[model samples]
Target: MQFENSREFARQLDKEDKLSKYRNEFILPKVNGKDVIYFVGNSLGLQPKTAQRYVDEIMKDWAELAVEGHFYAEKSWWDYHERFSEKLARVVGANPAEVTVMNTLTVNLHLLMVSFYRPSGKRYKIICEEKAFPSDQYMISSQVRFHGYDPKDAIVEIKKRDGENNFRTEDVLAKIEEVGEECALVLIGGVNYYTGQVFDMATITKAGHDAGAFVGWDLAHAAGNIELKLSEWNVDFAAWCSYKYMNSGPGNASGCFINKKYHNKKDIPRFEGWWGHNKERRFLMEPEFQPEPTADAWQISNAPILAMAPYLASLEMFDEVGMPALIEKRNKIVAYLEYVLHEIDKDVESSFEIITPADQDKRGTQLSVFLHGEGKELFRYLMDQGVITDWREPNVIRLAPAPFYCSFEDMYEFGQILKEGILNKQKV
Candidate 1:
């Protein structure tokens, strides 16, 4: 599909998009009654129409049932959390019993770390990428320090090649090999938030398993953006939030996956709460803390049913448009964005660098573009102009065009604004 400019290409792609109608299903943010091209779904997705209704039903349940909502409600609110499990499991490619919906991203990360990051006297180290989300860094450091281990000795962060912005798989495996004997776990984000690098999960999991380390993925970025085969890849555990690509609203409830391999094990050890006690006898007021034989054993407390309603709505939308279709749309949209951005003249080469990988297989919907000059100025300009995007530290702007609601035209608009911003900045 050759085209003279990005707008034409976008129009052509939209004309052929099978899920094009899904765009009108979202309540996109508007500027002066016009929908600003939204290219930040990687940070916060556009709201789905069904989301409000979903939450509203729960609100009605809360009003009608009050305290009785737990035991007796229209859908049995006590077990509402279970209503979401099968869909969450299928999305991550894990058995239903191996997955459960739970708390926020960082909370789930900490819970999983408690069960997975058990370091011995000699093998007391954890491996993660350099510049991981600050929360992950803090969690790892605090966990290491709490376990009476030195943070310097207990944490290994893989870096990119001397001047590169991404890590090489070979370099990563070599680092794993070097620390294998002393490594307790390897925790990696399935897709790096800053570089938008979709990692080779199968190979990484294989290497980590061979090294006798527990492997887990923080799929906060990769959850709905990519096709995950966590179980097939033999990934031991995984966690993700629903607010990003899942369109579950801000700070939606999170989900977890524990490989079924550990499901029937009694001594595998987890942080237990009464809500995780065997379902049949949960309300007996007994002192026993017997846990269910599945990932439900990892539940710390009853999930926020109200908070989870929007996620349920979003998951249903996912089921409507299967992952394969969404991935197809996302791949084209991002590639189009990259192509158009790269087409900008080289006169402003010093003004920015696209930190995301050139290959589609290596990225999701988000592209992290580093402004060589003043990143904040460009970011502010785009925001004030009503283009909603996100910014990370130093000087990088992230634009994630989610497949469910974001159109190719949005990408084209973003490209034009970005180029004009660069050109305008150069004049000053």
Candidate 2:
């Protein structure tokens, strides 16, 4: 698909886009009283227009039924989270029973690690990618410390080779084999937050299992941004937040996936709560813990219905369009964005590098641009020009043209603004 640096070309693509109508479903943020070009869905997704209605329904239920809303409300607060399982299961490619909405991402990661990260004797090491999200790095370090092992010794970080921006899949697999006998867990982000590289999860999971390790993924950037097959990949577990890409509200409840193979295994250690207990005997208040025979068994508390409403609303949209359609639009739009960036570089003589994988299959919606000459100042200029993107430390600016809302015209406009920003720097 050859792209031209013209608004007409962009608008023509928009005219052909099947998912263009979805842009209307979201309420775009304004800059100078006009909708800003939002390319930061990797950091935070725009809010769904229906979000208010969903929350209002929950509020109305609480107002009218009060305590009885647990069972009496239209959606029933008692099982509010269940409404998302089937739809979310499709989103993550898992069995309905294996997927469940629960606590936030890091919290779920800790809970899952409790069950999947068990170490004994000499096999206590954990393998993860270097420069993981700060929370994950902290979690791994703390979990290792909690298990009475020094992080420096027990945690192995796989880093990119010198002069590279991303890790090679073969190198990652080799590292797993290198520590096969000692590694107990292999956890990594499905789509790396910084470089936007999408790891080969299926191959990685197989390699981890052959190495006798439990493998998990933090899909914080992968979910809703790329197609995932957690169950088919034979992943031990996975977790993701709903705010980014999924377009749920800020600090919204998260989704969890536990392979069906672990569903009926009561021997798996977990931090359980009453919500995870056997539902039939839940109100009976049994002294002994009887776990649910599903992924919900890992849940430590009842559903946060109010917080989950926006996610339910967003999932409805996902269910309507399905991942296949979304991925189709994502590929075309992101390719257009890539084309625009290169065009801008060619026209403006800008010195910046795209750190993201060039292969569409190896990335999601995000493209991390590492500015070379005037990095921070160019980023600030784009921001002042109403290009809503995010700046990472050192020099990278992350732009995620989300398929659900962002248009081809937006990408074209961004290219123009980026060129202007760089050319303006030359004048200075």
How many steric clashes between backbone atoms does each model show? Answer: 1, 0
In candidate 1, which residue pairs clash? 351-372
lDDT scores for all predictions?
Answer: 0.85, 0.92
Residue 344 displacement (Å), model 2:
1.1
lDDT of 1 by residue, 183-298 (tens): 89999899998889998999999999899999999998999899898889999999998888998889888889988887766576678887788889988978867778888888
For model 2, name the residue pairs that clash: none
Return the top candidate by TM-score.
2
- Report model 1's TM-score to 2 decimal places: 0.95
Compose the digit string of candidate 2's lDDT tens values, residues 1-428: 77898999999999999999999999998887889999889888999999999999989989999999999999998788888889999999999999999999999999999999999999999999999999999999999999999999999999899999999999999999999889999999999999899999999999999999999999999999899998899999999999999999898888999999988777789888999998889999998888899898987789999899999899899999999999999999989998888888787766769999999899999899888776688888888888999999898899999999999999999989888888877987
Candidate 2 segments exceeding 4 Å error? none
